[model samples]
Target chain A: MYLHHHPFCPHSRFVRLLLAEYGLEPELVEERVWERRPGFLALNPSGETPVIVEEMAASVPGAFIIAEYLDETRGLALGTHRLLPEDPAGRVEVRRLTQWFNEKMYVESTEPLVRERIHKRYMSREQGGGSPDATSLRMARANLRYHLKYIGWLAKARKWLAGERLSQADLAAAAHLSVADYLGDVPWDEDEHARDWYARIKSRPTFRALLTESIPGMPPSKTYADLDF
Target chain B: MYLHHHPFCPHSRFVRLLLAEYGLEPELVEERVWERRPGFLALNPSGETPVIVEEMAASVPGAFIIAEYLDETRGLALGTHRLLPEDPAGRVEVRRLTQWFNEKMYVESTEPLVRERIHKRYMSREQGGGSPDATSLRMARANLRYHLKYIGWLAKARKWLAGERLSQADLAAAAHLSVADYLGDVPWDEDEHARDWYARIKSRPTFRALLTESIPGMPPSKTYADLDF
Candidate 1:
């Protein structure tokens, strides 16, 4: 399998974590989506990242669809360790949170923050590259604080974000949060519950790969890889 | 079941059509999401519509999550008529297109058009209401044309949007298009294949409810409900 992705994209990070958790490895091909390459667009008309092409050439696009695809194909192999719950209600919560992180949180915080801080640097002048927009950065930072409070509330109320067990909800939230954390945007000190939750997930064997990933001149925050942080 | 939704919201329409197809009836509660009602926000903090509350009070939120929840809880009884294909690849296609319409198409076309041309009409001045922004309307119209051509290409290439069988992909696309058609925004004559496909799906018995629906003052376009148009 070959996975077309970008390390800085949280959606891509979500899928990578899922693949690792499922013990499946794909040849990761980093894609600069802003370039809008025709070949990549053909793979995914949306020109988004984290598209998985099977050995047989069936391509699965979008992190949400890819998560369901991976679980449908391999969840049975992992038995109880599956990221998706078996019951309908449990699955609903898992998916709702997945959508929350990928769409709601993404539009509100991650997409703007990442686009302004990370993606723009990789883009050319004609591709909308420049210094980050201060207004957008300010709005995203404020939104992130509100989101962290919500995450803290959720962590305090449940064993996992979805329910009693770890599911895609945790992975999805962690995936987006990790991206912001890498840029030193997450105010972890203000939300202890969220901080502890992140610490637990960050220490997982599956998270090691992400810790080592970095952009050439843009290093991750100092404590990004520290398990104790 | 109780569905909190707005008639013109395509995501809500997608779930409504799915419920009709599955033969489950829900008490429809029209919600103006912009009001941000405390009750509605409790059900879905995202303040979006198409949230379903089951008889036992299990709240399933979001169109995509609700689609999966409905299928999982009831699809086995559907036998060969399941909206989600049984095979992994086909299921992926069905979901990929579902997301395409709900997120990509909605963002590019439906949301902007409806918000500007329809939603703002119902909002108070304090809520950012006024004349539609001409620039947004122009952009959404152009995007709709591009999307229609893509739909036309897909319609001509396959028996259904996803495959040979009718699935949520068809329902999702038609749901969004039906809303646009209601406003006379769809250029049906420009793409014969898309028009034909819409005609086929629009004639389904499950589509009856949506066809008969109308806003208080914003009556549907002349041909919105004409099966033979």
Candidate 2:
């Protein structure tokens, strides 16, 4: 199986982290989704990455479907341990948590940062020259507190976000944090539970590729690579 | 089992239509999600409806989970005639189509209509009982055409969307069209495939209730009740 992915996309990174934890490496092909290549469009008209292709199957599909397919085909026990819940309520919580991190967190935090600092270069549109607009960065910074607070609240209430199992909630949360970590947007000092959660999640063997990610003209925070962080 | 629904909520209506088609009926209890009452939030914090309570389950769940539960527990012979597809690709398509109708189509079309027109009574912040903005209505009207056109395109190419079996796609599309039909937003004249598809979907015994719907402020189109149309 091959994954069409972009380093900056949180969803793509979410799948990558899971594959990392599961120790299943795929042929990683970077896709510039916004560029709209005809060949890529043929694979996924939605123009979104995290598209997985199984050599035996029909066509490309999105992340959730691929995760499910992986579970079914590989008989991967990773879900039960690291990415999914043992029970129904736990599973729903995990899915809801995953959606919360991927969509809500992206809207509130990542989007503004990406638009101001990353989108222009990827689209080759010179808006603000991909500079971090002060207001957007401020907003992204403020929003991160709320997300972290929420995660902290969840972590304080349970051993893990999706319950006793480490689950996809951990992976999904880590994916968002990876972007924030890359952008230096995460406020690690705000919440102990959230901070501790991130430390454990990032220390995983699968997180090595993520730590090495470097976007042009942008650098990780000094503490980003710190294992203790 | 009971359903908490709004007549035009595609998810609620889709579940209703599915129940009807499968020769079952649940008591219906309608709730306006925007009100955000504690009672409704207890059932689903998302504030969306079409929640079902089953006697067999330890607890009730939100729509998709509930529907899947029903499909499993009801002992219904939906095997070949199932709304959900069996093949992984087909299943993914059907699930995505369901999400498309419930999430994207609702976001794109239905919510604007109900929020601006039907839901104005519920949106109390408008001190003047503010008239529905013509610009948004116009945009929504145009969007509905595109949505139906896309559905028409999908219907034309496949035997049944997700293919070759009368699945929930038909029910989902029919539910959305029924709501639009009630508000006279549907443009059957714009696409032949959509027009014909609606005719066949509504002709089912399940669609009889949709035909009888009437809102005090806005009556359904003259042809709304005409099944043969």
Candidate 3:
């Protein structure tokens, strides 16, 4: 299998973590989505990443779809490391939290902050990529705190975000937080339980590849790769 | 089952359509999300619509989660109305299209149009909703056409939006378009194939409830409920 992705995109990173957790190492190709390269668009008309081309020549796009695809195909092979719970209700909770991060946290926090702090540097001025807008960044930061508190609340109520076992919900939350952490945006000290929960996820072997990814001219924060932090 | 929803919210409507298709009738309770009702927030801290209280006493929130929950629990009982395909690849395709409508189409078209044309009337002047912004509506309309063309393209390529059999992808597409149609925003003449696909979905018994719903002081367009249209 081969995967096309952007280094800083949370969704892309989510898929990478899932792949690593499944113990499958697909060839990774970095995609510059803003350029809308015709080749990439041909592979996935939505012009987004990460797009996974299976050995059977099937092209799977969108992070949520890819995660489900991987689970359905290879999750059982792992024996007990399945990213989704087998029961219907447990699956519902995992998917709910997954969508919560993928859509809610993304729209309200991750997307705006990343676009402002990271993507703007790579984009042309005509594409609205100059200095980051202070107002937007401030709004996103404000939104981030509420999400962190919610994470803390969930952490206190359940062993994992969705239940007793690790699931896509944990991966999804970690994926978004990792990107924000790279930019030094996550105020980890604000919520101790949330930070502790994240620490557990951060130390996992699957997360090692993500922590070391450095974008050109946009290095991650000094503490980004530190497991102790 | 009980569902708290808003008549104009596409996600809410999507859940309703799924329930109807599954032959499960959930008692409906309209939620004014903009008001941020304390009771509703307790049920779902996100304060979003389409929260389902199942017979098992689980509060299944979010449209995607609820759809999967219903499918997993009751899909087998029906034998043929499964919203997700059995195979992994087909499921990925179905989910990809579902996300395409839920996120991409929503961000580009539905949310903006609905907020401007419908939500604005319900909001107080202090809440920033007196009149519709002409620019937003125009941009949403332009984006709508591209999405409609994409839908048309997909419809022509497959028996249903995702594949040979109808799935959540078709319902998702129809759900968003149904809302747009309610406001007379969809130019059905732009794509005959897309229109025909929608007509087939619109004529289903499950859609009858949605067609008869009349939002106070905001009547649906003349052609909105006409299946023959």
What TM-score against the true chain A does chain A of each candidate get? 0.98, 0.91, 0.96
Q: Give a tens-digit lDDT track for model 1, residues A100-212.
A: 88988999999999999998987889999999999999999999999899889999999888888888989999999999999999999999999999999999999999999
Q: Which regions in candidate 3 have their CA more than 4 angstroms from the true location?
A: none
Q: Which candidate gets the maximum TM-score versus the true structure?
A: 1
In candidate 1, what are the lDDT values of residues B1-229, reduced to their tens digit? 8999999999999999999999999999999999999999999988999899987757999999999988888988888999999999999889988999998899999999999999999999999899999999989989999888988999999988888989999999999999999999999989999999999999999999999998888889987999998
Worst 10 residues of 3 chain B by lDDT: B72-81
Ten-residue region with minimum lDDT total, candidate 1 chain B = B54-63
Give lDDT: candidate 2, residue B182: 76
Clash pairs (backbone) in predicted model 1: none
Q: What value does DockQ give for candidate 1?
A: 0.80
All DockQ scores:
0.80, 0.34, 0.71
The CAPRI category of model 2 is acceptable
Residue B200 alpha-carbon offset, candidate 1, angstroms: 1.0
Model 2 misplaced regions, further than 4 Å: A75-82, A126-137, B19-24, B53-77, B126-129
* Model 2 agreement with the true structure over A1-229: per-residue lDDT tens digits: 7888988888889889877767788899898766777887787756677877768775545655555555445534654564664455555667667767877788888767776767666565442444457987899889989999988998888888878878777888888887887777787888999888788878878788889889878778876888896
Please state the error at residue B115 of candidate 1 in Å. Answer: 0.9
CA lDDT, candidate 1, residue B174? 97
lDDT for each residue of candidate 3 in A142-195, tens digit (9 for 90 to 100): 999999999999998988999999999999999999999998888988998999
